[model samples]
Target chain A: MTALYQQSLEGLTRLRGIAGAMVVSADDGLVVAESLMEGIPGDAVAALAASLMRRMGTAVSAAGFTPPSFMHLQAARGALLVVPAGPDILLIAIGDRHINLGLARIEMLQAVEQLG
Target chain B: MRALEPWVEQPLMTFLTESEARLTLLMTSAGQVVAQHGFTRAVDIMSAAALGAAILSSTEEMARVLGVRPFRALSHQGESHGIFLSAFETPRGRWIGLVVYGQDTSLGLVRLFFDRMVDELMAGVPAEGGPKQVLAQNFESELHSSLRALFGR
Candidate 1:
């Protein structure tokens, strides 16, 4: 893998209670790199997530609300936390239903800062 | 009205009211107060209703062009977390807003509230056909076209 891919994997590895993580391009809804969940359809998840991200961003923008640099969604079945690595890149983590979302968000934020 | 029936369900309404959280629902298009339970005062419901309307109006526009459905967005402020906006489409093309708020609460409860509320909302509506067909036929193209113009997209 490329250095950027390895770096993202390393960062994702550090987060607690995350079931899987991926670096994705919200611009095209493609997965650039991922860690864990070897057999899962990581690409499809990335695409759907990126689409959701873009839709959410557009929605908030049109509402005259401040556009978010990150978006988080937690459901009864699972939780999804997305952090913007840049305008083009997003770091996404899916967690077990029991994971701590706040902690995961902070960890992802730290990773983003480090990725800079 | 079947559309308004679930709000009055005895156990379900009571569950919402007794939970250690704030809850409210609104009609997206008209921003009308649909149902509210728990500790939410009038101001809170009003604000959430407005927030929901704005978000739904914004997303409905995007969903039209993309042919994609919109989901809920959750925001957190300190220890108080609020999931203030989301869309649930009735079989007749009417959209309802479902919202819930909690303090130091579990993610489980929040999801439960959201699912239950949306399910209730959908249940009250006559399900003569499925959601996919209804959404496909009832695409809010006008909303999308207007938004694209507004946002220069």
Candidate 2:
């Protein structure tokens, strides 16, 4: 793994309840690097999250809003959080319901800065 | 979009919706068209199918000479557009897909959805008989008829 992705994923995985963190291509949804729990399907997560992000970006812009910087999808079992690292890259986190959103957000922002 | 085979329509449509591909062609490895989308003329479809099949065949032969397995897929990216070409197995036969995408979509997304579509197509294909044969004697007529069906001309 590249230092940028390894550092980002490693930092995100340290948080409690966080199942995985991945550096994904926003354009293609391919995982660049990941620190995923044993059962987590990183490829599916990256692809679906990137697809959702693209759809949401389109909808947001069509509603006269600027492109979104961050997005969250909370499910019954887990949650997905995405933040743009650059025009073509994304930082994504998968976590349980008890995960700390505030801390995760801060860590993700720092990771994005490192990516820059 | 139009499909010479009815079963191909739904899978092709689903692929288009998910991948956001601007143009797509699904054909046999032998260059016989089974379905197509976003093509305005018969000549374009025929040319693309022939070229795609030729490219895939030549690449496969090259891989053989190099003692490597044939490539799973090929892609070319440009400033404004990108093309993805891949071959997959089906109950019917091996099929090729040629996709053209723009800024709104990425190759990763296309490939992901394409894999799903292949699975769907494999399941959805009827198992009543062996694969259809495209004989040389009827090739031109079949091509013209398929084109007419696609364009309603």
Candidate 3:
């Protein structure tokens, strides 16, 4: 892994309640880099997250809003956070429901900046 | 979409809707068409099936030459469109799926749904005789018949 990718994933994975962090292709949903816990199903997560991001972008644009830079999906058991790293890449983090969204959001934005 | 086999229609329809594929063809390893969607001409479907089969055959051979297992799927992305090809096993026989998608969908989404479609197809397979064996002498006739059935020509 490149130093930037490793650093970005490591920083996110170090956060409390974070189950995994991945750099994913926004267009294809392929995993570029990841720091995942056991049994996280990284491939599925990456694909679903990218799909959701695409849908969100389309819906938001159709509504006359700019593309979203950040997205948070909170489910009953977990939450998924996504930040666009670039036009074709995304920074994604999966965590438990108890995760600190404020800290995670800030760190992810910083990581994305560094990645850029 | 039109299917040569009745059981394939539902699964293929589901895949077409979910994957947002602009064009799709389901065929056998021998290049016989089973179903197709978004193709306006019979000639185009015939060309795509033949090409897809040949490409898959060559790639499978390449994998053997390299001492690797045969690849399950392949994809190519162009500026305005993309193609995805994959083969899966069914109770009847091996089948291939060729999909063409545009900017409205991604390869990841197509593949994810393709896998699900494969599973559904397997589950929906009729518990009876296997596929009819196509003799080499009858291959040309079969191809023409399938095309006529699909296009009503």
Candidate 4:
């Protein structure tokens, strides 16, 4: 499982400013596996990403909309992008302020499919 | 910092009374809550207010960078429960509303009535004492007071 995740996210980190990545349990926001570098707090990102995913999932349903295939969070300093990997897991990418989400999103979807 | 006007409250109440929505809250884009319905605890409102504001802000920024339009509404559906967080503008300022519903109502219904509710809200807003352009010198204290009021702390 670790090998699979490691192989899955290796290509994603090559993108500019994406310092870290992880797979987290959407239920409790705990990390399953992570590939991280300095300056990115993986645990906090996992927690927020998991919590946000759970909320977005329900909010989508409550509004009569399709559940989002992915989520992207941007802050002044950095960004965290989340995409559903499976029913209960989320793949999170932590990037710097300049991380390009358009390309990053495409790359993450590929990583998610490859992980499957 | 401001309360939901009585005009706004009437329609919000009516919307809740008519729909199966379990809870609803009107709060600022920055997370300061104005008015709420169906919540008993301050902490719950505080949490909802904070989370709703954060989600709206993040998604709005994400849309700008991703080169897509910002999401007008967000939802999460479980087997029997759901929530909707959406943003609207009023004469006062930008506001975010979060609603909760269960099996008694459907998201389809929620979506339908929510539009009306928003329209009522937008029409009801008054052009007085709207939020300020510059942060107040005592913004910290004001914020704390507002939080205390919102959370009953």
**By lDDT, who's the top model here?**
3
Worst 10 residues of 4 chain A by lDDT: A39-48
Model 2: colliding residue pairs:
none
TM-score attained by model 1: 0.41
List iRMS (one decimal) for every candidate: 11.9, 1.7, 1.2, 12.5
**TM-score for all predictions?**
0.41, 0.83, 0.89, 0.51
**Each prediction's DockQ against the real complex:** 0.03, 0.50, 0.64, 0.02
Best by TM-score: 3
**Clashing pairs in model 1, backbone N/Cα/C closer than 3 A:** none
Locate the minimum summed-lDDT window of 10 residues in model 1 chain B: B130-139
Q: Which rank order by lDDT, best down to worst?
A: 3, 2, 4, 1
Q: Which candidate model has the greater lDDT, 1 or 3? A: 3
Q: List the residue pairs that clash in candidate 3.
A: none
Clashing pairs in 4: A57-B76, A57-B77, A58-B75, A58-B76, A58-B77, A59-B75, A59-B76, A60-B75, A60-B76
> Model 1, B1-153: lDDT tens per residue?
112335435434633653335554544344434344542244554555556666666777787778886545443434455564556556645555454555433333444455565666566655563433323223344334323332335
Local accuracy of candidate 4 as per-residue lDDT tens digits, A5-109:
987776778899899889887764668888888767666667667766777788899999987888888899988899999887889999999998899999999
lDDT string, candidate 1, A2-105, tens digits = 47666766666566667788888765456788885555556656765676777788899899998677788878887778888877788888776877777788
What's the distance in Å from true for residue A56, model 4?
Answer: 30
True contacts kept of 4: 0.00
- Tell me the whole-model lDDT of each prediction, alpha carbons only: 0.59, 0.87, 0.89, 0.76
Off by over 4 Å in 1: B1-153
Candidate 1 vs 2: which has more TM-score: 2
